[model samples]
Target: MEFSWLETRWARPFYLAFVFCLALGLLQTIKLYLRRQRLLRDLRAFPTPPTHWFLGHQKFIQDDNMEKLEEIIEKYPRAFPFWIGPFQAFFYIYDPDYAKTFLSRTDPKSQYLQKFLPPLIGKGLLALDGPKWFQHRCLLTPGFHFNILKAYIEVMAHSVKTMLDKWEKICSTQDTSLEVYEHINLMSLDIIMKCAFSKETNCQTNSTHDPYVKAIFELSKIIFHRLYSFLYHSDIIFKLSPQGYRFQKLSRVLNQYTDAIIQERKKSLQAGVKQNNTQKRKYQDFLDIVLSAKDENGSSFSDTDVHSEVSMFLLGGHDSLAASISWILYCLALNPEHQERCREEVRGILGDGCSITWDQLDEMSYTTMCIKETCRLIPAVPSIFRDLSKPLTFPDGCTLPAGITVVLSIWGLHHNPAVWKNPKVFDPLRFSQENSDQRHPYAYLPFSAGSRNCIGQQFAMVQLKVTIALILLHFRVTPDPTRPPTFSSHFILKPKNGMYLQLKKLSEC
Candidate 1:
């Protein structure tokens, strides 16, 4: 009876449909298996640690274990690969030869960064790619020229003085160990606000904090938390979660604050208060310069684009500079011998004066070497991310296909025994002219290298030189032995606990 029913007109069409669906499913399964097999075969050439066949290496990296991975890199020097599941793989490149080749090509940023940051940073130069990124880079390059950075030295010095004033007040009352990172963070925020937007955020002066600063700080925490949550990488899942809601709220606060600042600047420029023909004017600030820039297509940034770029600069500048400055201080505190040498160099140049002029900053050569060594040992950004836009062949002739994500571990590169001698020691003289000449150009990448390097290198170097020169003048900093900082892996390099320093007045010294 069933066979006879299948032979009928209605049954025949139903039978045909059923067979068609079955064949389609079988074909899809075959294609998936073939693709998986090919990915597995392609990954076999690279070296990987012991991993779960089902879970792959995902189980080992459930948390941030970059400190552990540094050990593994020593064993697998060519390139270390990690499998996410059965097929997906990532390469952590620690060798300079590999880093140089990869960075020389303008591959788009790692997919992981693009996924997490655009929500916070939008299409800013840090996150933008292709024609858009190039355009924005060109537009903003002029704002960071030497003349503009030189004019900002006064602003940086003022912010540093404000920080020192607070420190002095505390030291005068009682000699106590102070947590300096918090103070440095606020000071960096204040400096960036003044230098980038020509506004005094008063983060250093006001006891009542700025809401924008608080929101920015909290947002960074939220964003970093979301980035490591692999299950929440999906947009729909993340949006439905609690971190997502908090991220949205914090982002709104940040956007509102930046928008207000942008509008205020625009109004001031329109009213001609920002620039005047009759009065002698100072250099144009970053905000004014960015507002006046246009692309090759004769297009100016839209209000939204302007907001993104400003927010990018604000967020990028604040935390990274703060961390770098705090670590520089911490390194000096631990190595008092180096600290005194730098102080003597500064005293030789400035003669008990706290203020640093642009030309005077260049004369602090030993101090600059110490800063370079500090950066090499503990880079502000421990590792940077990249994605392969095309197949890449390393110096060893090992080839990686397109779409492979990589971590260029600045931490590993600095510590590699092949490149550095006595890598663990605090030797600032390694950066002297003769020693530096013997090193590979790509070996020390504090600000990274190649065409896509940090745009604020000049600004950051100036800020560091000024703050360091001033602090050494006023205070004798020593480490708190009880509370030594352990390096922690975060989006930016950070201390596991905190940085506590004993600040003795120079007169007491």
Candidate 2:
């Protein structure tokens, strides 16, 4: 039937090439199967929930609610298998010992989760691994030192005051009730702009807003939306999808904004050099430090590198702090007794509506406890995902092979019954000096633990303490009975509805 084509001498070579391609594909499949078999034998020792042949545990994740997810963790007790597809699986870990064992190792962040962020942050400190991460971390460490942070207090206070003033104006006018989360988010963004770029955003007072602020916010939503969609996981498919288009557009907005800031900072630095003005300023912001930083090779960071780090600082500084402060205020609003206690502590330290000094910040012990408890209840970054760079051994004698994915569930660890007496109780006393000394260090990881713990923990804590202090000084926060916020988990544990709280003047309360 194909005699016309087969008669040609080239037919044999074409047929041979087709067979070779098919053979190569079969060999690749065999290699992958062998690897999975070896890993699966080890993985089977750890308990897993029922999984489908094709879908695996994806159905569970798709239909996931906090309660159901928690139940699965509880049932597993230590770790569980979550297969992404036939080829990918993660050992989801919640047990403190297991988490600590894994976290202590400097594993690369899982590409699956980290991939969603590179468009926004580039290959910044958060996304980087190995020597690059170590080098960047060392260079940026001095920037967040206590002395440097102290120099930025006025900047932080200015942002917080702007937010408070806006709230005061709102309270004085018709709206006594307000959404606290969005206001705090704006305030955090304003602080990050000033702290990272040494630029005034005026987000609190300005009627017109920076496009970057809105774009970054929308970018986060788009990222998580794509993450859960599953089909969008493939870069090729995602780029063609509508969500991908929106992501690309928002990413461009953020990248352009970041690039502009870096360029302006570079020109300023050059002008300083040309003018022979080498005298160090009282404080150096994140951009200043990044520009000044030199690698072991004595080369300064590229504009791309500076851009990535700046993006990281902005995102990590803004959203995480906003989530923490918002949740703390929400917790305080719910428990008026604790709120009053915190207020009393603040009043004792700083009198009536006085500025929060660095020294005075340390004096608000009860208020600090409340913040700790809030973090314990709702860690800003709920879970951390990592790719096992080397084999990991747990206390149970079960070992996971390299190339496996590991999820360190910060939420699960905080809520583990074995660690806390009543995991759900809103008791600040859990963090009191005597009580804190009693628990495992890994048991409470709001900012995470080990080698990869948050670089900005101190910075975040100071902001939280200052904001809480100022709010307590002037106003009494109470929960809105009619519109209580519901808790949900995304990248950050968030209020599904906006966090609505009622504020009354201190004297009136």
Residue 276 lDDT (model 2): 40
Q: How much is the lDDT of residue 410 in candidate 2?
A: 85
lDDT of 1 by residue, 30-90 (tens): 8867866877676678877887775666553445565566677677765677666654566
- Give the clashing pairs for model 1: none
RMSD of 2: 3.5
Q: Spell out the clash pairs found in candidate 2.
A: none
Model 1 local distance difference test score: 0.82
Compared with the true structure, what per-residue lDDT tens digits does model 2 show for residues 1-509? 47877667668888899999999999988987886676678687877777676666766555536666667766677778777656567778888788779878888998887888886778888898988888888888888999989977878887888888777777885437888888888898899888887787677677335587678667877777666555677899999988788888888888888888888777877776522422343567888788888877897777778888898888889887888888998899889899999888888888865466899889989999999999988888888899888888898888888888788888878777767777788999988899988877788888888888889999998889888888888778888899987764667676767789888765321
lDDT by candidate, in order shown: 0.82, 0.80
Top lDDT prediction, candidate number: 1
Full-model lDDT, candidate 2: 0.80
Residue 119 accuracy (lDDT) in model 2? 69
